[model samples]
Every structure is written in structure tokens, then in C-alpha cells.
Target: MQRIRLDAAAAANAEDAEVWRWFSGLLEERRVRWRYMFSRWVVNVDRVHVATEQNFYDAIRMAKEAATRRGLGLSTIGCSRIR
Candidate 1:
């Protein structure tokens, strides 16, 4: 996955920064190379090797699930390929 759009409601929360920090940390712990852009509303994940698309999607799913488990309500609007 190259880009992910975060949920608007979650992005506007007062504790958004902390949530982002935790999310990014979780991604790192899972060995996913990603960074925030456009004021943290967008996440850019580094390119994955060919034929590893499932792994990338799994990482995203796990992160989203973890966030939801923590009551964060995190959601991705979309994910795009880098080309």
C-alpha cells in the first residue's frame, strides 16, 4: 500500500497526536515502513516487494484492528498502489 486516508472524525480528535504516535509505533513494531503526510491525515507506506501485496494488506489490517481495539475508530478511506 502506498497511501492511506485516515478517518476524518478520528483525525479531528483532541488526542489525535497521541493516537497517530501510537499508530505509527505499532506499524514500526510490525516492521512496516511508513510516515505521515498532509498533517497526519495521510499515511504513506513504503513500497513492498513484488508478490508481497498480501503482507502489506495484512499489516494494514492488523494496525486498523489494533486501533479499533483501543477505541480509536481508525479507518482507511483507501489504499493506492505506487505504480
Candidate 2:
């Protein structure tokens, strides 16, 4: 499995004061690898999402499976559909 990374460092420079402050909450930097069941693909990422910390492994598996089963690409897991 290959590891992928999703860095949110761009949030550090967020124009909105509230957004920038919120980004500050991500004090830790990390990454995780997710295996795709139906393909040779994997997702590596890092962020401050609660679901990521609590059920990241499962979430990735579900996302990968969902994409593969539906014959879609990474973009298939849209930002609004991740939950």
C-alpha cells in the first residue's frame, strides 16, 4: 500500500480571522494510510477532523470501497459527502 498525504497548512494563511484561528487548533501534524479493497490504490492524509482521528481507518476503507464499487475516482468522495 502506498501512503498519500493531505496537508492543510494552507489554512494557516486563511484570510478570515475566524478561519485562521480555527486552523490554529490543529496543533499536531500527522498522516495515515488507507488500503483500497478493490484496487491497487490507497489514500494518505492529515487533517484536524474528528472523524479522521476517531474512525479514520474505517472511514478510509469505506471511502475507497465506495469509490471502487461505484467505479469512480478520488473526486467521487466529495467534500460534502465524506461524512
lDDT of 2: 0.37
**Judged by lDDT against the true structure, how good is candidate 1?**
0.43
State, as a TM-score between 0 and 1, how close model 1 is to the true structure: 0.25
Candidate 2 C-alpha lDDT tens digits along 15-69:
3443323223321222334444443334443422222223534455444444445
Residue 78 alpha-carbon offset, candidate 1, angstroms: 17
lDDT of 2 at 6: 23
| Residues forming the 10-long window of minimal summed lDDT in candidate 2 | 20-29
Across 1-83, the per-residue lDDT of candidate 1 in tens digits comes to 22333555555564555555655664654533433333332223323311112344444545454545554433332546477
What TM-score should be assigned to candidate 2?
0.24
| Model 1 per-residue lDDT at 82 | 75
Per-prediction TM-score: 0.25, 0.24
